[model samples]
Target: MLRAIIVDDEELSVKRLKRLLSESKDIETCHTFMNPLEAYEYAKSSPVDVAFLDISMPELDGMALSGLLLDLDNAMDIVFVTGHDEYALQAFDASALDYLLKPVTAERLDKTLAKIRKNRGYTAAEPALSVFLFNGLRLCRSRKGQETIRLRSPKTEELFAFLMFRRAISREEIVDTLWSDLETDKALKNLNSTLYYIRKAIGSGQTGDCIEAGRHEIRIAESSLYCDLYEFERLLKQIRSAPEPSADLFKRAEVLYTGEFLKGKSYEWASEQTRRLEQDYIELLEAAARFHIGIHQPQQSLRYFCEILKLDAIREDISHEVIRLYTELGRKHEAFQQYRLLEQSLQQELGTRPDPRVEDFIMKLMR
Candidate 1:
């Protein structure tokens, strides 16, 4: 049996390899990485038997990651899997375990993977994962804490990440997200200006056609670095499928929050994505609370529910649950006060009454 991680910037390639590897009973797909830098980081933190990799990526390339990964784990060998044949020699020169061209044949991949298994007794070290834009009405969101060129809200940052995310965003969609109401000429000028700004912020020409901004579509540079949101989503899936109560729960919750999901922007809130993220945020809070509860820690549940309240005040169910916990812990007056506060907020915000269940609970409490 072989444990493997596929490192490819191409989704199709990743999908194919995953399908092929899944058919093999002796393989466990450890983790698939889209960026060399991330692969390098994870390689340091996780164990990987074979790295089916590509040569070019943002932040780092296959060659660079291969070299760095080798240093991190001298016994870890790289099996370069890519479209270009020219890099084969460089792959071998880097002392990579092997170089297998893309559109990978089962036989070749098996050979490469088998070679990796044959050398599995080795250990390696590795280390450790953006943006929104709206048109002439270019709305940029900067991270609340850092000014990382990647995290910053440059036009290019928005363009780059957007392309990476949607795999392509249309120029019209870009304009729509940024300046849906503007004239075509004005929109184009603004888009170009924003791109220039992005280029300046990240480095000249970094987000070129790789982030295709053509008449009908815009897409990330197929060869650029990976998006944080994508990786964040990937971790979310991992945590969901393998539900645990420790670091993964919190880490996944943190990533899904992503600082309010493109904060500081007011463009197209009605889009499916905007609605979806809002739902995910609420779900993550609930997930966090559930995990905490399962771990025999009611306080953790209490705190997560508080976070949920910050986003949503209508969840009288959670509010009441927390209040009951507080009361059961011998804080009766505190819980009663919580009911009063919620009643006041509901009246002030919705001009309505608490749900019947809550009203009954409060009535019972008052007695």
Candidate 2:
């Protein structure tokens, strides 16, 4: 992983770089400096192998920062994080080894690193692990179906999450996940047991054929699996390939994102998947609800509309929509009771109140 710094006075540019870096788990630290002087101090104290510097600053310019870095004899390298190409050219004039356009790209950064190693003799480290292991090599992969576990390690949960997300993985990958402190033979036994348990879980009810083991590779039995993760990804691909956000796609996403995938699990690999599904679910739920409303399926619409509230109760549109459906259908008592429950839930879980739209719905229903 690369430990990097964004030394630009512009907050937006720094934010963009930080976000792009986040997509790469290879990054360890991403610091933002809004002032040139502060960045200069950091440059002097540390061996900042890769410095993202901006030109046209209040104090020292990007050129000077790069010059000072090389002068430190720390083998520090510089990448110009500048807005205009002209600024990059100016910095290059000051002997800045390399230059990058604004809105730093992961691909360009990779290219820059490759160039640096070739000329300056700086070798980059290997990329970080796709899966992390912990807690007795109980492997879990997200890429696979509720399928069998092929690998076991200290971070088996995270490993399983990865495999669940990915279709297959190999034995060497599994062994590398094992902790160095354990005896090799005993570790393999535990690994087999962990795989057995994962298969049992996947085949428990939904499907009996969800895992396939081979000589060196193990994978999810994609032939007949009902993975929420797989369903969500399929919907995403459909949405992308579609001409527009169709009603069908939204509805599919709504039902597919029933609950946070792997909810209440402490595995780190599932965290990112949970967040992504939650975000997509919220957006698609509103669209799906609208489609259902247009088709006069308010009861079904109400089901979806209410489900959205469970994930994000603050969205007043969903609450109001559900309440109005109950009222217009002459179910006023249910509307009021639902309001009470919603209010109590918000107060208890979020320590907040429902939006005024919810209260207004109660007023409408009271009549």
- Measured by TM-score, the strongest candidate is 1
Find the 10 residues in a row with the least total lDDT in model 1. Answer: 125-134
- Candidate 2: RMSD to truth: 13.8
The reply for model 2, stretches above 4 Å from the true place, is: 1-158, 166-227, 240-258, 349-352
Off by over 4 Å in 1: 1-165, 175-193, 205-217, 221-228, 243-247, 255-258, 269-272, 360-367
Model 1 lDDT at residue 338:
74
lDDT of 1 by residue, 145-231 (tens): 234444345555455445454776667777777666899889878888877666555554543333455667655543243344554
lDDT of each: 0.64, 0.64
* lDDT score, candidate 1, position 211: 47
